[model samples]
Target: MSRVRTLEEIPLRKFHWQMFFYTGGGAFIDGYIIGIIAVALAVLQPQFDMSLTLVGMIAMATYVGMFFGGIIGGYLTDIIGRKTMFLLDLGLFVLASIPQFFVTDPAQLIIWRFILGFAVGADNPISATYMAEFAPSKQRGVLLGGLIALWYVGYGASYLVGYWLLALGDDSWRWMLTSSAIPAIILLFARLKMPESPLWLASKGKVKEANAIIQKIFGKGVILSESFEYKEKTSFMDIFKNGYGKWTLFIALFWTLQVAPAFAIATYIPQVLGEFGFADGNMEYLGSAIMSLFYLVGLLPAIYLVDKIGRRPVLIWPFLVSSVVLVVLGITSSWQMSFALTITLFVIYGIFNTSMNIHQWIYPNELFPTKIRGTAVGFGTGVSRIGASLSTFLFPLILSKYGLEVTMYCCAALFFVGFLISFMMAPETRNMTLAETSTLNKPSIKFSSKPSPKRETV
Candidate 1:
């Protein structure tokens, strides 16, 4: 058997691409559903006669559901299995989306949006964990980064769908919201055919099943004996007990920093545009389309650079540049200057934000041991959603009370804070095996009970 200790030794093969498509498709659906809501709000506002604050509340409600869903999904993924959680999330998305087409009241729309958000949140932690586990160590960055890029494609598609539906008239909003269900349904069938995670199976004491799946993907006669080991059944506290407490805290903070400014900027894009003399009607829609296009364009380079440049540099540099852009955007009040600054900041935001997005999903899975990977990822992501939920309310209020320039400056400052936190907390996991990556930050734990036989030393 080969004794490979570093990520550089893992060979690339066809199986990784197969896993990428399945996981990426799941992320794509998430982006589609979430993006559709943003566009739908634009279409629905005139019909409902709602204020911007109320609209922001509708978006916030979704994140509130997502916050709970992420926690539940993470724990369930570890206990039940990756494939099962993945398939179930798709099912929830389909159920929630169908009723949205028929909703007449703002309350009904908010309720359905929250339900859909819960499903999207559940899918995120599971998909990120499953994709990282299946990928070879050397290619984890690219494979995972590509999955993020696919999500932008999903986001862009929503904008295009909204544009076409708007051209068709008011009835089109129903079509745009309900149309998201089709992709969820397609992903449901595709997920059913995909294999369970071999690593997850092995962690669960189902060694024989794990080996069978691994061999199927890696081909017959591939040795698995070295990889198989008895593992203790893990609980939520295992995250803190097994040298992971500090890392977990850091990751949670990292996610909060990312989510705060990102949601703040995104939730108020149309309002910000309108403040600068852009009309509140189709002009807002056109501006959003432009921003979405810029976001999609930014994702391409992130896919190419994530593995080559390392996670820390890619994630950090963008926030620093974005901080500058946000400040500049805040200072400019003229319509022409605002347009130039908005486009520039968003393009920068898209590039940097997409880079950070790649790491947020990929890093937590790699940072924790296989025993507690899902739990850590779920909790970290859940915390981030809470930050996003708060930003939904906070940004608009900040803009209302303090005005646009102060709000933009606050967002810029938040990016700097995120940069500092990440610099101190996040370790570089580039080109490292999951096992090696987990060891980068050691934790101090006090075990209440004696170690079980299943808890083998690394």
Candidate 2:
């Protein structure tokens, strides 16, 4: 009998790309749902007569919901399994989005937005893990990087939809919100036809099932002889029991710092443009439209370079460069200079920020064992959502109190913190196996004495 080959031995080709698309569509749904809300707020503020503070509150509500959803979803992902949580969360997003069209009050809109955010929060960990688990090692970076690119595509699409709907001027915020439902539906159908993660199956001690799935992907030669032995089922305490406590803390802090600047810029781009002397009417929308194009362009190379250059460089350099650009924008008084500076900063920020965002999904999933992957991801992401929520609330206050210049300076400061954190602590996981990556910084226990050899054989 011939021995079976491992999955890595299989050729990389269209099959992997097909899988990337199916899984990536779920991410697109996630991005579309979240990104569209920023644009819709511009239109809805006028229609509903909302105060700037109230609008910020509504945006924060979504992040608040995301905080809880990420925690719950991450916990459930390990408990009920990834596929189950993925489907259920998709349903929640679809259901939450449909109600926005019927909202009669700002308060009601805030409630529904929070609910939608809770459901959408599950996407980061689940989709990233799903893609990583299924991808061949050689292509993991590109596949995950491309997944991030697709997410930005969704972001760009949201802006395009918002711009077009607002132009209709027929009270079209409903159309803007409803547009999200289409992607959600498409993802639901696409996911139905996809297979479960074989790595997850093997980790759960279902070797035969895992092997069968692997065979389908890699042909019949892959072996199933390895045991599915794992440490006892993990709990929240496990992150601390091992030496992972420090790592987890740093990751959570890193994510918090990351979201602060990114969300601050993203949530207030239109308002920021108005400050730069762009007309409050169509010109605000036009600036956003142009910025969105730059965003998409920045996202592509970031994704392409993420795996090729390794995670650390891709993550750190972009943030550092963007920080300098943001500082320049904050200090410049010339409207034209500030506008060009803001666009340049936004483009660089989008690229690095998108790269960091993609890795946020990938690294957490890869950092822990399958038993604890969901929990760690949820905790880290949930904490980050808290940061995002705070930033959303604070941005408007900063704009009102100190003006856009000070607010942007604050954003630059946040990015500087993130840059330092990434530079100091983040691990290089590119092309490494899950087992290899999980052991970083773990302590080795040395026995006080070596055990004597058994002498009973005679």
Q: List lDDT for all candidates, in order.
A: 0.76, 0.74
User: What is the TM-score of each predicted model, taking all chains together?
Assistant: 0.91, 0.91
- Model 2 lDDT per residue over 1-458, tens place: 55454454344767788878877886777667667777788878987788889989998988898899888888777766778777888788788888888888889888998888888677766777777666655566777777777877777778778888886675688888878878887777667767777766766767678788878867776643233343336577776657778778877987888787787667777877787777556776767767766666766666677667777887787678767778877877355654566566567667666667666766776677777787778888788999999999889888889987888789888888888988998877776655556666565622211211212211
lDDT of 1 by residue, 104-199 (tens): 888998898888888877887788888888776667888887887888788778877887788778878788889888998988898787888777
Model 1 stretches astray by more than 4 angstroms: 1-10, 221-229, 338-341, 443-458
